[model samples]
Target: MLKDPPITVNVFDEARVNHEMTVELAFVNPVSEILRDCSLTPSGTGLLQWEELTKLPDLMPNNRVCVKLIIVPHKSGERTLLVGFDRASFKDIKTSCIVNVKP
Candidate 1:
């Protein structure tokens, strides 16, 4: 049985504050409603947003888990937003993204 690979998206500097590089993650899964009560934290920054999440109605399997995050490049290097799934959904799958904010 093959497992579905993790879904990743890039965050451009334009999305950041003052072109600082920001990313908005919209995580949706088949169990989104069930995990509605769940919360997410980016790099230990604490809960971001979830109340107004746009649920993705199309998700494989009746039981699934997804995550989204908006990251801002604080420095010149690459910063990865480690997505930690709560309630023991699955192992941690991290997605690394690069943000060049050199003006």
Candidate 2:
């Protein structure tokens, strides 16, 4: 079995106008493993929780990836946040990295 890569996904809270945000990570393999052996760590929480990947799709050989992460806000200010991830995984997709936007 190939071990999954380690990734760090960041969150930007458009409401805070600062860096306060919540970020959780899940993984999808073309082999149909959704969130399998995945984990999430919130900033300053100092804790990591393991979660199951329920809705992840099967990974196909040479297949690309599309991550749908859940944005959980720790504060009560604005409830929405802009989402994005690094392009180190989806190299063949031929798309530009999405710029952070207002939510």
Candidate 3:
């Protein structure tokens, strides 16, 4: 069985309520084989809206891929944002990053 790749999520800058925030997700295929049928999206803490869908191609082995998501925060204060990953060959994955949103 192939092990799933580790997902890294980073919230960039500060965000205000009702404003847009950007979150970056990066991952590397540590296995010797390429990760196929990969999909990335934002999930959980439904306080934010997905502004765009990033079409992620199959990631090469041992290479890193970074994806940025533009999200509009609905509420303020500290919130746990989730980055979701769906793959055809493995189980789904979700990584969280706590972000402070101002009022």
Candidate 4:
């Protein structure tokens, strides 16, 4: 179950901006074990918030996991937030959202 649909971010007249957001990922079936690793890749000028890589614990069936993300825009323009998720025993998933930077 995923919640909190993605939205557009507005950075007004700033060279760099940081925004905090959350994402939820859910499992459909019961698995022996589950692990999650998340990352952010920017198409333009931007960076991820976290410095270290970490894995989440196992999740049960029909359960959801929430991830905290920090988005930073290095320049003023249109940017894209590329979020990647790696799950144990599952294929990697990716999602992208648009961000508008104003100057």
TM-score of each: 0.45, 0.29, 0.80, 0.50
- Which residue pairs in model 1 clash with each other? 16-22, 23-70, 25-69
**Per-residue alpha-carbon lDDT of model 3 for 9-54, expressed as tens digits?**
8878678787777878887776688887777776645446552445
Order of candidate numbers by lDDT, starting with the best: 3, 4, 1, 2
Compare the candidates by TM-score and give the number of the best one: 3
Better of 2 and 4 by lDDT: 4
Give the Cα lDDT of each candidate: 0.40, 0.32, 0.73, 0.42
> Which model, 2 or 4, shows the larger TM-score?
4
Candidate 2 on 1-103: residue-level lDDT in tens?
3344333244433423233334434333334433232222222211112332323344444444445444333333323222222233332221111223333
Clashes of each: 3, 9, 0, 0
Best model number under lDDT:
3
